[model samples]
Target: MPDSSAERPRRIVARREGPMLVEGPVEIVLEDGTTVSSDRFCVALCTCRRSRIFPWCDTSHRRHSPAARPAADH
Candidate 1:
């Protein structure tokens, strides 16, 4: 078993109106039940599921904001 502890804390920067910028070493779990560990310098995660990448943000929030958009439109 691998020790899954926060060795190097990744910085999660939440934009006031967009995706969170995750920088540094981190682990990622996909909805499909797969886990990936990476030391990638940066990753953008969606607060909204508008990303074609699903969990990761491709900057789709630039086009629309879930908080501002009407629920019926979703």
Candidate 2:
């Protein structure tokens, strides 16, 4: 077995209104038992489920924002 602490840490960058950037290549298991992976040097993971490509960001979060959303009438 390998020591987890001894391994170099993977970096993740969280954006305020968008996807999180992670160092790749990474493998992920979904809630439905499906798996996904990316071999890119970096990967953008959707924090918001607005992605057409789930787990992978498609910049869909940019279409609407908390600040940009229209206010509901009282």
Candidate 3:
């Protein structure tokens, strides 16, 4: 039998240029009093303030960089 207290610790990671990564099975309470939850093994919390899916990372952080964009067709 395994000890429940010996379970691995949850982790949260912050990036200098991207979203914050958090261990999942998380719930968040928004400013509007709405609640959101995710059960993913890892969840990415938006930090760039550019996600259409606010509170979640939708790769919106990459959109802000000119190098990440494709050149326009003439």
Candidate 4:
């Protein structure tokens, strides 16, 4: 339990157009004071506020503009 990795702080990766990644197990406190927890190895946090699950990325940001995508080649 005295490992150096254990002494290190949690790592978080942020992206402009995507979710922010954080090393888990994490507990998130929402605006209303409710707390949510996730025990997954990695967690994706919503940045664009488009997540159906809010605070947790449901990839809703990716669906922001379906029409903006180029038409598929035949």
CA displacement after TM-score superposition, residue 54 of candidate 3 (Å):
1.0
Runs of candidate 1 exceeding 4 Å displacement: 1-8, 66-74
Residue 72, model 1: Cα distance from true site in angstroms: 20
Question: Each model's C-alpha lDDT?
Answer: 0.75, 0.88, 0.86, 0.86
Top lDDT prediction, candidate number: 2
Candidate RMSDs in Å, in order, are 5.7, 3.7, 5.0, 4.6
Residue-wise C-alpha lDDT for candidate 4, range 1-74, written one tens digit per residue: 13547667889998777899998888899999999999998999999898889999998887775555788999
lDDT of 3 at 43: 97
The reply for model 4, stretches above 4 Å from the true place, is: 1-6, 65-68, 71-74
Tens digits of per-residue lDDT, candidate 2, 1-74, equal 23549978889999899999998888878999998988888999999999999899998898877777878999
Give the distance in Å from residue 43's predicted Cα in candidate 3 to where it truly belongs. 0.5
Q: Who is ahead in TM-score, 1 or 3?
A: 3
Off by over 4 Å in 2: 1-6, 67-74
By lDDT, is 1 or 3 better? 3
Clashes of each: 0, 0, 0, 0
Better of 1 and 2 by lDDT: 2
Worst 10 residues of 3 by lDDT: 1-10
Q: Show the colliding residue pairs in model 3.
A: none
> Candidate 1 lDDT, tens digit per residue, 1-74?
23548454557898888888887466778879998665768877788788897567788887786676767955
Q: For candidate 3, lDDT tens digit of each residue in 50-72?
A: 99998999998897867688999
Error in Å for residue 27 of model 4: 0.7
CA lDDT of 71 in candidate 2?
84
